[model samples]
Target: MQKRVKYFLIRLHYLTVNSNHERLHQDREIIYGKRGLRQYWEITTDKETISDDSTWLVMTKIPKINYKKVGKIYQIRAWVEYGFKQSKSELCWADFRVTNYAQIEKWWQLVMSAYLMVSLHSDSFNPMVTPVSEKFQQHDWWNERKGWKNILNNLRLIIKPYLSFNIISRWLKVFPIPQLSLGLPRLINLMNEFDCLRYFVYFWDNFYYSSA
Candidate 1:
């Protein structure tokens, strides 16, 4: 039996959506503009079910694009949103206090630079990269990880040594006398005595593994 839709004077009847990205319905409406005329699509997509939040309404000015394109656009939007959130939280991107448009633009450029830096490291660490990270790929824990935030974390770790060096060199006016503290060799001897070097790991151990 063929499905039926009942249209009334004031409203359109509900559509039975059956699959994701399936175009439940689409129509164009007049959008008057400076160019004299424009058209837009009022689109609905199926989310694979009728009872759930299974239908989505999408409005786009591009009337030529199909429902699948609309779905991909939204998916891309989700990825963009995720990247923006990462910029804010991980890359120290912040709201601009300067009201000048030029300053705002400069801040945007700096933020984008930081974002690109993190993205480079993140891409390198991604298991799905064209050339996999062969060193850690075999570890079960490495592949089953949750998010790329760890890449930013490892980056922070990498910068920490330089930061410590900078602070100690420039800011420390009083230095610890070599006689007062155990030297690195003595410390290593103590470590060997306690047998703790293998267990006590570097910051990258948290970034990836104890060694690599």
Candidate 2:
């Protein structure tokens, strides 16, 4: 009973849907500016550094709370991806949760290694591209927009991917791609692209292709 209550409270705190009529302007301000893409930092939680220092460019995209029970701890990785001719350095923050901080650090190290390893090829590692605005515009329901804002507003909070298999299968019906042959590792990499969905679209298309 206690566990159930705890779970309910956590879920409520995590996914509460609030009416924005009073805060419409405020929500709009949050949705379109630096306030829209909120970022936060914490010194420690459960003996872990919950957020990176401000000296670096830090961003986190968390999933949902309910999904965490399945061992899908939300993750974020921060590292220096580019360098400039100045004393200050540039860093990128990515959200992806693992069960423990060890995995978090490992993933962060992987990206750092990738950045350094790829530096031999180019001065920058540009493996991922931000989805085009047109893609988002097509799915522009008010709630969808609100959800996007929620993601941006709590970028640092840990969350499990909010999507489900049924949700994914439905999206697959829309695309007519013949096949996607991505092996497991590439699939994981694709999932890392977005905190939610975590490459949900990519997963659907690839899975659709694989089935074909």
Candidate 3:
């Protein structure tokens, strides 16, 4: 029975991975582009509204940033504050003040829902849903199909603790992951290749923000 259970667990893991593998890759490409040249933005709130109190941005370069899509910038900021880490390089934390954690929590839910949808449907997991499919039809997490709903529910169960830990950790000043040590050449390369880096970074940001 134990062997059978283990086998079942293994198979279940693969099934989950196979089901969404392709979609992940596609999702990465969709938001980040081929080379990942997308810019990132962060926002923070002070008194009440989301404002320029404390904002940290991880970008390929400042010059390549597009200010047209300001909404996306806020979304990215929410993702970071919620505990998502950079996929590639370390980003300097910009100081910003939020009025309260309550407002950030609300934004987190919306972003989380969007992130799950794209993750399940992107090309990395052999994403096989159609536009007509019920899953692709909406961004609401509760409205997702049974399988996806299960996944999202499980994720939420996991995420809440993670978020709480993150907030506490940041406040207490702990490093969950070690900071990177790159020399001047690599730093210059990061800035010089901002176009590609921005795309990749922004793509990840979109995925991360969608979780809220």
Candidate 4:
């Protein structure tokens, strides 16, 4: 049935649907049945060339009058899928083991923010040239034009050393300490050794008092 419809449309030579420079010939038909069944538009694109063997089909609740927008929506959907794929695979978005809904939501927010940060940072560099120093040239992952995943991985390696106990301790001195004897390293080490509940309590205490 589908092949017959496609052949009929091809014979008719339907008007071209312009979607981002790709000229697609589209034909839409409305299918109607019982009152309980909702109406839908069955849209099919004619094959572009003899080499292209398949016809693209889209079924939508949207009216036939808005068929041009459907092509654009599909183009945008591809980009959205690409972003999700990169986030999950490259950014390790599926690595979390949390059972709480709130915790999972927060993790997704952080992962998206991190992904956006890497994307923005990569865009700042010239695509034709390497953004790193000569020292990074010897590394296997280093390239003339680094993708978002490579940029993010390299950024993690570059920032890891600066997040050490010594660096964090120095930075924490700016905050007014309640106990001078309780150094940042000792306090941080204690927090590291704490169980999940203790850590949660400590975090909430700091958060509540900090806001006050």
Candidate 5:
């Protein structure tokens, strides 16, 4: 007693608008798939040539939807696919080997958290770690790192110090408290170990960049 509304993409060879009807930019026309599946379409074509790959042959069963809506919906599909791609390839969405549901959930949460961090930021905030300014963008490293991959790497360096307590503790071994062993040492050596506070303040740019 009920049905689902959907769109089916069919090649142009098996479908064309009714010849008796005067052609318009967008017309509700009959469509026939290669396998003979029939549906109505909001037909649109290129401004110059209607044939070849210029035709966007999207068919749908939705009532009251226009050609513009169809075009926009398909355009949005591309971005959705791109997000999934970044989630998989870039964020290692499937890289975790957790056996239990809770472990898998946390792993995916961490993965998506990273993906969300990068995705939510705008290109205006380029290099990511630092706010984008005309003077800042003029650096030599900035020229080579005008891409998202470099932005992610820069973000890691910016946050590394705050996350390095465990690693720093391993290096120092023990003073009972992690802060006393790791944090106090770094704070004490801030000036002596690295020359000046200028290098400590802008450690990523001056110290890390120089070392790299």
Candidate 6:
């Protein structure tokens, strides 16, 4: 019976998610378990694609609701999974190796913060800039779907000098003037390469001239 249902679904025309001709079958069943008898809504898609040759079958203990609502909820879940994949793959969300609880928590917070910043500036990181170069633009992160990591790396390189200065001054009460001199030039060159010097200079000038 299950095999017949599967074959019928695969043979149906317009088996995609957007198909209006698709059908949903819902029934209540007492699923046996070690705890006790549990009732669930066994929602099966008559023409929804699960794989190349199969349809989807979902079981939920939630109260009876519209099938379209269930589908919408599933779609949202898919998007959430996509976000987790992005965080893990592009933001290095799982790259830490700390065993201490506090350190692990702090690392996760930093990673999440960096991910948020990169996502907020995703438009600026586009690889489809005009006057494309064969050598440089070809390897652009946006072009290769690796924009998040590239943005994080670029921001880190540009801000390393200031961050280093802050950390050193916090610990030693004195600024490392020698390191500043060596770092600022390289930082400026990097900003120029990333085409962010104008914005950087603008912000610097504003902060310098602003009355606190």
TM-score of each: 0.44, 0.18, 0.20, 0.42, 0.42, 0.39
Which is the winner by TM-score between candidate 2 and candidate 6?
6
Q: Per-residue alpha-carbon lDDT of model 4 for 19-78, expressed as tens digits?
A: 445444454444443322333333445434423333445455554435456555654544
Q: Top model by lDDT, which number? A: 4
Question: How well is each residue in 56-85 modelled by candidate 1, as lDDT tens digits?
Answer: 344566647644455556534546787778
Report the poorest 10 consecutive residues by lDDT, candidate 3. Answer: 6-15
Question: Each candidate: what lDDT?
Answer: 0.45, 0.30, 0.36, 0.50, 0.50, 0.48
Better structure of 1 and 6 per TM-score? 1
Which portions of model 6 show Cα errors greater than 4 Å? 1-66, 79-83, 98-104, 124-150, 160-212
Judging by TM-score against the true structure, name the best candidate: 1
Error of 6 at 163 (Å): 6.9
- The residue-by-residue lDDT of candidate 5 on 92-147, one tens digit each, is 76666779988887777777677656543335432334344454334455443545
Cα distance off (Å), candidate 6, residue 126: 13
lDDT of 5 at 152: 57
lDDT of 2 by residue, 96-147 (tens): 5577888877776665553332232221222232332343334333122323
Worst 10 residues of 2 by lDDT: 22-31
Candidate 3 per-residue C-alpha lDDT over 128-197 given as tens digits, one digit per residue, 9 for 90 to 100: 4322233332435534354433444534533444454445556445433323222433444433421212
Superposed by TM-score, candidate 2 places the C-alpha of residue 59 at a distance from the truth, in angstroms, of 32
RMSD of 4: 13.9
Rank the candidate models, highest lDDT first: 4, 5, 6, 1, 3, 2
Residue pairs with backbone atoms closer than 3 Å in model 4 (clashes)? none
Task: Find the 10 residues in a row with the least total lDDT in model 1.
Answer: 5-14
RMSD of 2: 22.4
- Model 4 bad stretches (over 4 Å): 1-65, 76-83, 124-143, 163-212
